[model samples]
Target: MIRSTFVRTALCALLAPTLSCNMLDVNDNEDVSGRGARVFDPYQSSDSGAIRLSLQQFNGCAILPSGSAVSKGTLNLPGYPDTCPDLLAADPTSARSAPTGTLRLMAGTRYFLNQLTLSDIVLNKHTNGADLTDAVRWMKNESRFRNLDWSDLGRVSDQWTFSTGIEGFSQDAWTREVLFDNARWRTVKDDTFTVEIIDQDGVTPRMTPVVYSRTDFLADSAYGGHTRVGWRMETVQAPQSPGDVVPHPLPVLSGQPASPPAYRTLVKIEMVGSTNPFKTFEAPFIPGPAILKVTWSQLPDEPFFFPIELVTPEGLAPTCANADGQPVACGFGVDPKFKFSTPANGQGYYEPGESFRLFLDMRDGDGNQMLPAGVLPSGKDMLADKANGLLYATQASYFTLLERDSLPAYMVAGPLQKLQVRSDPQAKAPYWSANAESVGLVDSLATLSAFPGVYGSTWTTRYSVNLPQDAEPGTYVALVKTQRYFLGERVAKTNSYFFQVGQQEPTTYPNAVGNCQLCHRGVLSLDNLRHGLGVDHVEACKTCHQRDSDLVPRIQTLIHQLHNSSPRYTQNKTDCTVCHLTKESALRPSMNVCQSCHPSVHGDEYFATQFSAKGEPNRFGNCAQTCHAQSTTNGHILPEN
Candidate 1:
């Protein structure tokens, strides 16, 4: 197969010079770029940003190849020893040389990086053969580069600048690039640099270079603020165009070629400097959970350097403290499962005009309160705490209450009722900044309520909401979504709880006939449901997708139509058991539900003729009790599994 691929590629190459070998990559397949044209936004181009490089070289100075030197004495560049030995110490002659390489820069830093922006920006455009790795696949199809596209390709703040004030870096200084619209990139860690060595042929591996800064090793203390480092790659041979044909001997049969093509990508560091000088002495560290201390030096032969300063202050590390200025035990950020506890509370019974309170807590994986009940990181202490690391610094929080119904309905009817943010009485001011012009403080907590503790991770929050005068008497789902900055990355947590109004033990719709989690897990979780409301279950879907949902179809009708057309539903879509766990419970005869699968049943001719004997104008009445009661299960087939 390898030989066949090589032979085919070689054959295509041979015929390329004289003829248009467009079939080499077979363009007859679906045009991926064209298919995605309607949604393509020119401004959404990921590589639209650029970075500039200015190499700093002091001639006659005994600088190490790593771009570091101590008053000039000896110069070493490995394999090229004595390259600049016995250099003058006071040599002031300096020249900046623009080396030949490709400078690559990505937008945003780790702390502020946004995945949605990264998802849109694709770094590599090549998509032929092995290069077609990033192409989207159907259900259960795993690609080797599954996560390659989701890397921290931060949105470039401008055409040139990118910030480095990430998790481990200081927030004092940032490049000129303004972080508008919540755009972000990956945080810069100590070993974030991608360094590679190549042979003369450009296809062979060489030795890795030691990367460091002029003042000290590439540590957290050296990388905060506006510190920036640009990367460049120099290949031995220029990149070959897809249409270019390379002359090579024909390959032997049985997947063996005379010479297999290889590539050597040598990373060359051309420039390393700061966009601006450091301004503050405070750097954010995660206390004992994520402390960073640099204790390394650069080698004389290493060929890259950035200037970093060690900020010194008494007790620079921020400790978790209570509002009374006493110390407390705490960690860095919220856990993936931040909504630790939300009891049913048996508060299902409520009067139409009466109000009810729902309580919940947002905790970390270690069962620690999101924010200390009595302890608060605010004012100068908050700043000092953030200089160490932030905890529960919410960027935004949304609470949506939806009333349940036997059938889906529009918002005005009875589906969506309320949307609130700060509902807890103890919640003081808004912790997030909704203004595009303002930057949110990294130390603000989501809920500062000092509510009494119940669970080990108790940070209980109370949500008070009143029922409408004509409110329905069924279950209500309250979705609480909180977005915050944790260890420099913007993370979100969503929790949904069910309660009743004007009823004893709220009733469920039983619309969730199937175990949808079988397919909708992990990356394909229900968070993608209905504009990302974090509705993790199919049952929660009925709240918004009502029978009178205005522009959208009902949940039952929508699910049937969606799965029928979905390419991922390889199983017999019409099979009742695929979605319906039990036929007797879910397979009720209803013209409204059946027409979603068989639209022909909605016509006047079918309804009139089919129900002529029954003497009915339309089949809107009791569908099962009339003619189709027993026949409802006739056409449906059961799955062997």
Candidate 2:
């Protein structure tokens, strides 16, 4: 009995002391209380109980879970020996495959009894700076291994045998593929149940560190001279029953010398973030004999941004709002001028006779309002003039309109001057005062009154055009615009406000956008040069165009100068049709209009004796005599002869 107790105690202390000492406490009654008894059962674990695990990770990137992979090239510490050496004992030339790169993992060690089990390894992830990879970033309050894959790679014993491959150094071309993939680039991943070990007692274990370079190695403090996980048993628990004097299959059948339960551990992993944008995949594994830690790797976040809103308040500005043309909060005229949009459906019933504020909002493709300029200084007046007046030049606003017609000459018209407004996206419209559907879709007007908001600013520049009570009864469109001049000359968004008088009209400003955009295409914001004046869907020039008696800029000439009169408009421009918004024949009002271009075609000096077939005096030269300068008749106006 004495010998049996000694042998069992020795074995228990050698292999697993946690459960080793408690195995003998099955007695119903005993005075073993004074025998220095402390219960530690590795096999039993519960939430908020004993038998806890503590994982200490070395490198920030190393605590990653298996199946964690890196990309195309390898990342090696300077002067470190190359990876994957002597990986093939079966090779004739004994070639060692270079690792694409190295990956880190949550690992721990135990050398108590020369027996290492999952229970011995407490992934010390609970420590500070445990994880650095984007795949996993745990904060102070959150660090608990919830999903773990525990593997029991047999045991390493006090014996000897070394030829080619060691215990857990899983290698081969196949292993390389498993580690990275066929894409032989220097890519790597934490795909294996990779384990690197060093005896806590300083006694060398098994396997060997794969080496191609002999200089330096992994920066992990614990990863200095370690070998891959490889175990060979020096001693294993005998399957015999402890009470039996003779060994028999009976104890084996009864499951003597039971192993500890597998640890279902919790490991934090971030699947995607930063440069590593990878899709998720699973690693192959066999069920081990313990439960402890849980592993996690989640998807990364997406492109993020916040846009600005322009505020345009209706009616006269509040007395305080007139911040000496400086940026005040506009209608609110105070702080918290920072505003988001209100998603709305129905705006008020607007008619020509009624007056209202002109407003607008600029957004990204998602319709999310964006801050077009720098953020205002904490207490800066958003309603006051910013940057001594011209800072708003960056996000400046221009108003224009086009007259709508039945079979119209143009689609829209005029920077209709018939309303007043305060500049502020947060400012409200009396007609649009109804509760909004959602928020953040700002139909607003914003300014760079606040310092550092943007290179430019835009405010509520309103007009009070009297829609003649007797004016033509039809619909008109007003286009609210913010030209991207200071940076790139591009229109930020398309916001057109429409109102009707009697009925809605259909108008076609054929190819206005197509033609005008040709020369107006570049957005050069960095320079001071003024590019072509930008045109929006709202041809607001019609408001001023109604009284054009001079042809110095027949509307066509007005547009010509806007383009800096690029040859596309003159010099090489011979086609009059390019500027006309009409049927070819309808363009000619009379012969006098033609004389402007073909002045030589008419004159008393040139056609003094000329007369038509009738014996009357000819007021102007005939098409053949003056209009067609060619010796022969010009194209189709005159006969071929």
Candidate 3:
């Protein structure tokens, strides 16, 4: 929401090259090697260079049914004061032993509620902003947690806790982990069922159980703070006749009442039913209580910490409905096909300051056509207005032009030059016009004719971009990402398009500085990089990571420091070649890069003084001129391999 009074088109002048806008008579870009400019085509589906499309999805907490009981209060124990308190008592230093609490089961159920658990919790936030120590501590603690001994710690069948689950798989993918052995438990039978809450130390016991009502638990700041906090009924046993009231006691101490005096709840118990694929363990409890029918969708709409899935489209058509609401076949696959269609007679080549138009054939990841195409019920060609342009259907609302502020195209000059959307400021045109598109349709009558009124086709949703008059001449890359609805799920994909502008040969960026595979190993594919683009090489990351005058050093510094702080990165801290592919690339260090590793050697003031020589600080700011020289390599111990 950074609103700017400056016109959007006027902003283009700030980024485009100084060279005059002019068309190239021919494609002189030798780097292209005579390759056709057709990067993606849904109809052909045979272009090896087509940007890979993957489904975008995130896994969310499986919501419980409406009447289920969950903890609702926060417990502030001693030691850690205001950082982030817990809903349950988590004071590890407390010396209390086997503190008892009562549990009551209402009548009409066969078994009484036997197991109680404090589940779905995250305690600490490990951040690497101003202090690197927090991140380092997080890594170490995570390692210890992953390797903890279950036998020695003792298991509490009903209890579960969550973690950020760094460096490995998590039940909810970076969201939750089952902290089964973390809790200590004791079982006792009083007038009503009761259990003892134990401290994590395996020695000190809690004074009294801290159980919050479902409402209070959800209201705590930490309840929705990081992940979620709530207790679970892990197991149940013993038959109780109708109307039998078994009491569970949770008393108020200094601050607030642990929970209400009494509240009826519907609990989902372990039973013979479809299993949750994400759960790590099988049924820890025997069959008890009635099972509730629940449903979930693979479609990921809700945002999680980091939510995006990368996978090649299977081209599998999903079941869809026609405009008439009748069942129909959605053509095939959700990966939208794209290709340049503007600047006619240019042989797929573009020039500076040219009208650029690209065609995107929209499809739901499931084969449903997103935009209306084919023949209408009136027997008129759906694309009859191709001479002009067709308006998008209401469903087009699902399509989003990501990175609206900054146009997706980048000029691969000395550094990455962000291309702006062409605008007319003098005419008072909005600066955002560069990202604006006059939506149109491409003829798909050849194939879509058969699916008349079925609400689908191999039609293209067109976008027209007017390149700035002073647009730089070089290879231009457009990383297009669009999201659409697929069946009941939200799906998206990102693809890269390479086209020449202003005739310098279309050479790829010199991004071979780092040997990413040395550490990433077999997982260094495009999907693993997870930046959305399908290009296998790391340079594809530059699409967004390109040096921005405003946000350059922050990312570089964080990345460098994060790697140096990782417990898993065992290489010598100064070993540049471990990641750098060539000695020259490693030797060409900038002040920002050096400072990331040697924070204690100098202060920000000194770095800024050196950058003053280059006018304004940017990605190219270097220390070699003012301080570090060739001898800077002498400080590092290079591997002999």
Candidate 4:
């Protein structure tokens, strides 16, 4: 009985040690104190607690539930020698296929512990057979690995192997299109291990599948160099599950019909402001990411490419708040949303009816600044003058903004006094001629005479006329000449109206024809030259003539000399009869004689006469002779004479 007790005691001693060893191993593997399982605490610090929990949660449960096996799995990955020599250098060149390896995984595990000892793992030379440098430099400068947080992983030793705890997870096979390559994959297995390969070019080493446990569950995870690498835990059925059921529905067919595309709403803005005659408001345009539609009137015909930018109120002068209560820039092309800096010495904004004076800083599409004169300048005031003074005869001349397929519409603004005229004249009585000669009138007198039908009361007229009691009873002609102002000078001339007058006999003379002082109230005389004479006497031969009967001949000669001497009045020295007739005869009423008195009025040469120098006496020549004839002259000269 004592011997049996001894044998039992010895057996108990042997079993006691074995039992203690078992308990220690179980404590190391099981999740205790609510700490996560499968988390290898190499540093064993409070800071690692969160990382431990995350890893365990991601893997579903700890790999070794209390009292499990301690043997860990071995992972061997195949390396492509030709394409990736750094990983597959040990393999023979003839073996184009990857070098196969094995991973010894303990059965029924959620996570695995692997000691990647530096001495056990070997880094192959790169394609150029260059040795790998510092891993930190590779992670930072290499494109592929630049985004990876290297501090999160273990450090690289002289042997370049990293010791880590990997969570075992499964993924369904997925196909991905390789960038810049046509090689497609039908299916791949989920990989259990990962390693970074450094290239000789110092590029970030790409992490490729080294070992995949389930080929059917693997996915093609190739991505561009910039793609981020991360992992997520998924609860997938074990490969050895009992049921034969499809896990997820096949991905919905690609290229399915989609809804029609939608378009963005566009807002249109119109800027209105006063303009000056001397400056142009280059209408400002505001640009944004959205498509812009600009609408304006009084703009140039061509599209004005301008530099557009957002601006604050302080940066833009003459700015005012728009309807939306936002400050808008003023001046030519001032867009409310945009700020503009004009050229140096710019006159800035201009008010309507004010002299325009702003100059724009021109630019090209590339935003290169240009000089004002190189494009358009304020000094060239043509555009401003046109905008302020001229009316567009056609709708097209007005400014407009139109869509690609739309018809152009006109703007509503225009210059003042669109159409202007200078004067109106009354017709002569008793066989009156539309020609100016018959009326014995010159210049425009309709304005001064206050003639009812001659000068309309709406605008000012330069002159008006009155007739004398001794004026001829025959028909006389009247004339009105006008000059248009442009750039401080007359640029155009026009004649407006012509009408007839009847004889009132001796009973009365029209008040308009009776008052010469109405138009000629201001007068100044210098020697024989009388300027500022009444409109009636402006060009009248009698204006300088006296009533002495003996002086009639002398007055005629004096009148001829005065016209001949004035350069502004005549082109050359010529005889009085060259433009006038001394007789009342029809054939003697020289058309040339009338032309001589109003030479410049006809502009250039006058038409030739049909009558000869000795033609039969006509009423025109007969009247001329009655006034100024040779005392010894015989009867009228015949054409045959």
- Top candidate by TM-score: 3
lDDT, model 3: 0.29
Query: What's the CA error at residue 184 for candidate 3, in Å?
Result: 16
The 10-residue segment of model 1 with minimum total lDDT is 397-406
In what order do the candidates fall by TM-score, top score first? 3, 1, 2, 4
Query: TM-score per candidate, in order?
Result: 0.30, 0.24, 0.38, 0.15
For model 4, where is the 10-residue window of minimal lDDT?
51-60
Looking at model 2, report the run of 10 residues with the lowest lDDT sum.
171-180
Give model 4's TM-score versus the native structure: 0.15
lDDT digits (tens) for residues 283-313 of candidate 3:
1111122111111111122111111111122
Q: Clash totals for all models, in order? A: 27, 107, 17, 59
lDDT by residue (139-188, candidate 4, tens digit) is 33442223323343322111000011111211222111111112111111
lDDT of each structure?
A: 0.28, 0.22, 0.29, 0.19
- TM-score of the candidate numbered 2? 0.24
Candidate with better lDDT, 1 vs 2: 1
For 192-223, candidate 2 gives per-residue lDDT tens digits of: 21222222222232223211111111111101
Where in model 1 is the C-alpha error above 4 Å? 1-349, 367-463, 468-477, 483-485, 488-492, 498-512, 520-537, 545-568, 581-641
